[model samples]
Target: MTVRGPNLRLEGSTFGPRKISAWREAVAPFWDVEIRKEDSSEFRGRSDVYHLGNAIIGLTAASELRNERSRSLVARMGVDHVAAQIRLEGHATVEIAGREVPMAPGDISLLDLAQPLSLRSSGYRAMTVIIPRALFPEAGTRLGAAHGTVLRGATPYGMLVNNHLRSLAAHVPHFTPAEARAAGQATAILISGAAGLGVESAAERPLQRAPVFLAIRSHIDAEIASADLSVEQICRRFGVSRSGLYRLFAPLGGVAEYIRRRRLARACRDLVEGGDRAARISEIAYRYGYGSPAGFTTAFRAEFGLSPADVKAGARPDGASAVRRAPTDLPGGGWDDFYEWVLTLDA
Candidate 1:
């Protein structure tokens, strides 16, 4: 649902300089504050606040001055509350519910508004997601495991979630009402998944796990130009055992075959639309991970019944004679429509 809230602002010397003050005022509607120090000198300064979803998800990032403080105060907070904060730039030390938590880039902290908490923020930028506690049955108990948690590249789920957040930050605005609702539900599922709650429905477990696989696939696609884009390399980079990685790809053939097919498909499109007539077949083959041109030609021919040279030569006819290899079109087509297809996949 489209969330509605008051039009609010924060102003005054509470944010240090006039420039920073203006920014603080703009964001004050969503964050309560107690600024400790205001000097240009860098030292521990403290700020106290809680974030609503608007300030948490809508803003790309918020800049804040460092502060040093100690206090525990929260009132009327309920079970249906969760706050997700990720450091976008700069560092912040967060202390929540009596625990010391250090935060850095790609790290996510789940704040429980029901309990007393404090945050020690240095010069920093961050994104936060506040979820209602009522939405999660095991909210309080599970939140302890997620509080002040660090989500870095070290963990597969962490990387996947971070990547999802990055993607969402860029596309959240384009989401329609239905898409937004779905996206919100997906967000809750992801949080639960990360928290080890295993709260997904029977139908959602697969898609919930799809992010990690999707992350790997996207990584492979971007690195196809590299000669060492092998399944082994992917396993090593993502910390998945060879067997485990294979299991993740079993539905789409084997990992090695999947990479080959993807590369060949991309090469097909490039050969047809890239307008590089003089592009050497051997060069194109090697560029797409084929060590030998002959092997590439064989695979290419097998995939589309046309050799690389024939395809590049435009020997494939344009109409009914030639196969117009493409996926099924949606009722309403484009990216959002394509996402419908994506959502339908077991992934």
Candidate 2:
């Protein structure tokens, strides 16, 4: 199988007002791009976008500019999707409903297309994944209110998502149709989990415990290295009753199950990457709070369907080849494809 991508490509590399006009034409569907008259001479921009039938991913970079989706524009185009972005090289401020959200490099943010927002940025590069609202109906009310929410890249959840989005963008081309669809669904689920960090909408009033729920997850992730990490300690630290904690984690298989999965997940990464130091199997187990090598091995294989030694030897649990890239005969979608991809995504 050959790898192919970048279904839609847009770039303006020349000096002139018309070049800027062309750039705006490319971005007109999703956002209105604005650049000062004189600054047009120095303007440069480019975006390569891909479609996976279930999601749209884009890699974009442009000179300093302002982008907006007015309330009128929101009504004109009824695209209901959520865009999750990771800033790669520059910073910006997103203004939504009069509130300003400052974005920095490595930070991830969510934007609900149904809502209007304006973003002003210095020349920047970014990677974005756009998912249809239909897939996340569970978070609809919460997500509609999550516009302009930011997840700091320094946080545990943020780092995991940050790395996954980047890796997913690069690996999309090699994905088979089935693999791409599965990945798209998995990406949507992963993002909904992270959406817990998003701002809750007062109008929805559905996420009463969202903040506390997010805090507990963060605390668990930070303390995963300690074998003694337990529900009793968590309750004391967060000042929540044991039943409250259980209720918060019920959707994720309870707190203890969450912690166990997290520990094994971290250990699996260590085995696969081998990091700066190739730790022994027993050491990896102990480092992740596993009591014995045998126990860790059994748990890891049960969760991932692969043994620790298999992972160390470079066997991917997902069955995708590690380094597979070749030119493919993929459709080179013209400008119209961008509009079609976002507007009729589920089709």
Candidate 3:
């Protein structure tokens, strides 16, 4: 099959007994999956996957599959993504973080990839969205206890989210890169709101810091090119106190560190995938507000353990290089933009 644009479709009947192995390999990048079958020959399964810029959505149907995340597997994989499963047909149950959740048609439940999860399903079909943990900082507290919280599709928010996912799936192929990014942002915002993370409108008078933090973070991202970007400017712009800003960013290692890290990350992406062969390293550095090329190179080396030139060189398949280039075929703005969108969910 000619795979294009991060999309994939797989069927188990094509592989016979090796079907289990095929399934494991297909999802190994995202999850550690296992299955139990009374007779291996009778096993049947199919999966359709769509990569939605920041997240991956898959529609899967299988005959009696079980996923048991072992301690050894968890230690080896270090998985850091979360999967939100929306049941479309049949039934399934998930056990995670000392909580058990059951699902019927039109019901959704969340599973944290970091924790151990045991799922059992029989003749099941579902839509699963796999999202990075960093994309939902506002839902951090709730996500800690999100394992067993089931959202019924009959509710208003549930209906909205479910319908949106269906529509997104139907129209994913037609979306431009920019539209995909916007849809991904909308997905995160809707999930945050559904999880009660204060993603409602500002007119609703949300007193939580999540919304305010999102706004302030959006402002910072927009103004990152400005050399004068500072905590005081952020405070004045957002009407937040210096102390409040510090407290909000304390967990992220302070506001300045966050900005620096974001800048370096963007520079790294540009060096590898910016598609401007003649663009000088110094120009990219200055674009992100670095005072000097030397300073930018030093910081980039410290963060990525390689020089900017090494990173750029790694993208080409020549001789051995200091670093291996990871895949950069993602639509939209990649990880940096995804993080910005996550922080600005309410925006």
Query: What is candidate 1's lDDT per residue for 1-347, written digit by digit as tens?
Result: 32221112232334335544544333332334455454432222222221222122433333454321111112111122466666767776665434566777777665544333456665666655656543453433465335445555346777777877767665655554456455655666677666663321111122224445556766877886788889889998998888877766654455776677667766765676555544788988988878799999998887667887887777541110122222232112222222112112110
Stretches of candidate 2 off by over 4 Å are 1-3, 137-139, 198-330
Candidate 2 lDDT trough over 10 residues, lowest sum: 319-328
Per-residue lDDT value at 317 in model 3: 16
Ranking by TM-score: 2, 3, 1
Q: Whole-model Cα lDDT per candidate? A: 0.51, 0.72, 0.61
Q: Which stretches of candidate 1 lie over 4 Å from their true place?
A: 1-31, 40-56, 60-73, 76-79, 137-141, 197-347
Model 3 worst lDDT run, 10 consecutive residues? 198-207
The model with the greater lDDT, 1 or 3, is: 3
Worst lDDT run of 10 residues, candidate 1, spans 69-78
- Please identify which of the two predictions, 1 or 2, would achieve the higher lDDT against the true structure: 2
The better candidate by lDDT, 2 or 3, is 2
Cα lDDT of model 3 by residue, 1-347, tens digit: 11233356677336347876676655543445656556466677788765655666678888777766543333223334566778888887766534466777887776655345677787888888767656775544345334445677787777888898788777777777667667767776666566663321102122136556555655766777777788888988888898888766553456777677667755665676654473688998898888889999998777656787777765421111122233345432322232232222221
Residue 102, candidate 1: Cα error in Å is 1.4
